[model samples]
Target: MLALAALLPLAGASFAQQKIEQQMSYEQFKAAGLDRLSPEQLANLNDWLDGKLKVETAKAAETAKQSGGDEDRRGLFLATSREPVDGTITGNFTGFGKGRSFTLDNGQVWQQIDDVSLTGVKDANPKVKITPSVIGSAWYLSIEGFNARAKVQRVK
Candidate 1:
């Protein structure tokens, strides 16, 4: 019985050693195609994945900014393609108010102003007006023979 017990321990040890020897190295594992990833390849993949994630994150942030808050208001003004009649043109505001008005080419002249509701962007309520000063510091939307001015405000 004592001899048998000693041989049992030796047999276990040999079995364990054999099992360890059968294990493959990293390189051999790759060669077998079971684990075909090199360290450099893994690093490059990680870097590329990180870059893609960053770009997606940035794009998401930009989209969120454009869709949220009062400052996200954008304006589009369509001008008449025809020649101005007596320095006056007509157009519509496509962003906020579906307003139509006549603009004068000369400063210090005011025509008619209207208000409208807009959706899909920031600043739901937009106020629209037509001014004669074409060189104002405000953002201007002009097309061919028409001009539009859009001002965006955030609702607190």
Candidate 2:
């Protein structure tokens, strides 16, 4: 149904009897070699037309969900390559020049994987932000007021 409608804008023709001839422009149909097609070949292609319609329907539904038509679809607007997670660290953050694990108050546990760390911040329950890598699930954590970002991964 949607594939037909998409072609409608290009063809400027109305549909009839599930036939592209009535829906597609004459030049476009000929360009696709439909004019040279045998009746059996055309019937075979038409038999698979419903698959195109299904793909188009799924695309439309995803577009609607991403556009906020469904309020319950949280994180739809965030990049799939990297997502943002923010919370308070469970303990006073000390510098970790090697590796360490951080447990957020929200129960998300992340472990540092890099060799960079910041010292001197002794505040309890400091705010933390974790941004995953732009290409994959590899994550980095940054404590509020700190300058260094450590490579991290979710442990829980």
Candidate 3:
């Protein structure tokens, strides 16, 4: 239900207008001079709205996937972003074993959510990528040339 609410904006203009109309109370509809619609006409209107809703939902999903705008990434934990981040880790590249935080050269600060040890690379200001998660506002940070990554939430 929450996802549907979030998706309403992606629905096309006509569908959005219909959705608003469908939500109107009977009295509201009458007040709007739409209560003159016969039973058959109302049924037909509802059928048309249902079909439009389905198409709009599918289109929104496809758009989200094609644009890397969905949550959970395409396959790995790493996300896709329109503006791919190319920056350096401001400090040593260690594992996120103890609530480690990453401060990028771009001035973005992200903290690891869990104790996921993403080791095997230790460098000062190593080039990395940070992409927005498809599902939520959370972001994923990864070390360059490495598969290790962590789901991070921006703090500063």
Best by TM-score: 2
Best by lDDT: 2
Scanning candidate 1 in windows of ten residues, the lowest lDDT window is: 7-16
Candidate 2 stretches greater than 4 Å from native: 1-81
How well is each residue in 98-134 modelled by candidate 3, as lDDT tens digits?
4677877867677788566766656777887876433
| Tens digits of per-residue lDDT for model 1, 1-156 | 122122121100101122111344666545545344566764564455345445544553455456552311211111111111222232332344533333333321222233534334432222333222211112232333223443322111
TM-scores of all candidate predictions against the true structure: 0.23, 0.47, 0.45
Score each candidate by Cα lDDT.
Answer: 0.31, 0.59, 0.58
Order of models, best TM-score first: 2, 3, 1
Model 1: clashing residue pairs? none
Question: lDDT by residue for model 2 over 1-156, one digit each (tens)?
Answer: 333333421110112226556546789788766778788977766655534544544554565547555322212232222237778999878865556888789777777778886776677888988864322235678888877888876666
Compared with the true structure, the alpha-carbon lDDT of candidate 3 equals 0.58
